[model samples]
Target: MDVADLAALETGGSLWTWHRGLRDGTAVVFDLDGVLSDAASRQHHLKGPRPDWEAFFAASGDDPLINEVATVLHLLAPELIVVLLTARPARVRTATLGWLDRHQLRWDLLVMRKDGDRRPARHFKQEAVRGVRERGMDVALCFEDDLRNVEMFRSEGIPTLYVHSGYYD
Candidate 1:
């Protein structure tokens, strides 16, 4: 892979390396909340969980797609099996789908936190990515903004591209 090409991808605050690995046709996993949608820092505080998720999910308030994120998504749309792996509870599936529809964001798979799985966010995400791999999909890269999750993924041998959070002030 060309160093310059990799550096160019980082220009959008994303270390995108999927295109280089696409020769073998691999899937790409993306964290939806902070990377694609400005949900974490803008919609609610990161330190506390939202008191009412059903209500929060039902509302269209947390629907803004981060700039430049869509460009990468569109670029990857044609050849990649875009998997939107999120830590969102399964109970919010309906509302989440609504939000995705409103934003016109489509995914080949939408992995969510399973009921009764109270694992930390980092572990939960690692499992989500692993679930995809278990199904025989070669995950070329993961786009995420959480450093903790990035470390977890890297620990498991999955390469991660640090997605600069739009949530930061």
Candidate 2:
């Protein structure tokens, strides 16, 4: 999904929210599934688990629009700290990192759900991201595909770019 797709998720939020209220030395967060990887493009029936299809979920291609965003960030937004915030399980970390490396997407920090943590995605992200912001690491923006997460983030005053995902397709 591209800028227009992000715009489509908006309910009158500023399209250029990235520039508004951003301070120097802030962190920018990117959601992996719909924002960086092609997980959103691939057909997904049931999300959350598939013990038999671990490999399929572990390794995947990049979403075209997000791939371009990575390049733009690498060059123009190098000053801002980059973060990859994924709800994927911890078991997929190695494969996920490999994909990120291949795409040359820089992530200063990576966060994932650990094994046996069964909290809902919205709750998990809300707590984790809130912790980061509370620690004084200013979060300038978040690129996400899940509506549940977008609502939580925006409610906390963090600007979000909502990308279209197969979950809603």
Candidate 3:
């Protein structure tokens, strides 16, 4: 089907537009960290220096899926506005942006948590998704690897495609 037809499929709907342009004017939101890279797994394996956290960001060098996913996004929906919603600190904003650029990924928005909030990460992510949805662009889908975040997105009526990380495999 065409982009317009896909966009009108449902209110806050998600359809596989991997080979189709975005419906007339809809945005696609993606979760960074776990979904794009094996951040969570790296973090889990590297306990020496906060394994999970370090591995999440440090494993950027050898990540295999970054280019693959980027290529898919580039080919499937080049016109769709892409956003990266993450709980990473705002301090890493420059680094994150650099990573995306280096990987040749296209994204429209990068939402990060503020400096001093201790709330649960999932809550912060939910708020970010809500903010994106309120901006007049329907959130077509969210690519995520965290179950809690997935649940949060679903609770907010956002459809999620869970990346099958090696943790479960």
Score every model by TM-score.
Answer: 0.72, 0.72, 0.70
* Residue 137 in model 3: lDDT: 69
By lDDT, rank the candidates, best first. Answer: 1, 2, 3
Which residue pairs come into collision in candidate 1?
none
Candidate 3 RMSD to the real structure: 9.1
Better of 2 and 3 by TM-score: 2
Best candidate per lDDT, number? 1
lDDT of 2 by residue, 78-115 (tens): 67867667677666655665676577666666667665
Query: Rank order by TM-score, top first?
Result: 2, 1, 3
Off by over 4 Å in 3: 1-24, 44-65, 166-169
Clashes of each: 0, 0, 4
Pick out the ten consecutive residues of candidate 1 with the lowest summed lDDT.
6-15
Q: Name the candidate, 2 or 3, with the larger lDDT value.
A: 2
| Per-residue lDDT of 141 in model 2 | 90
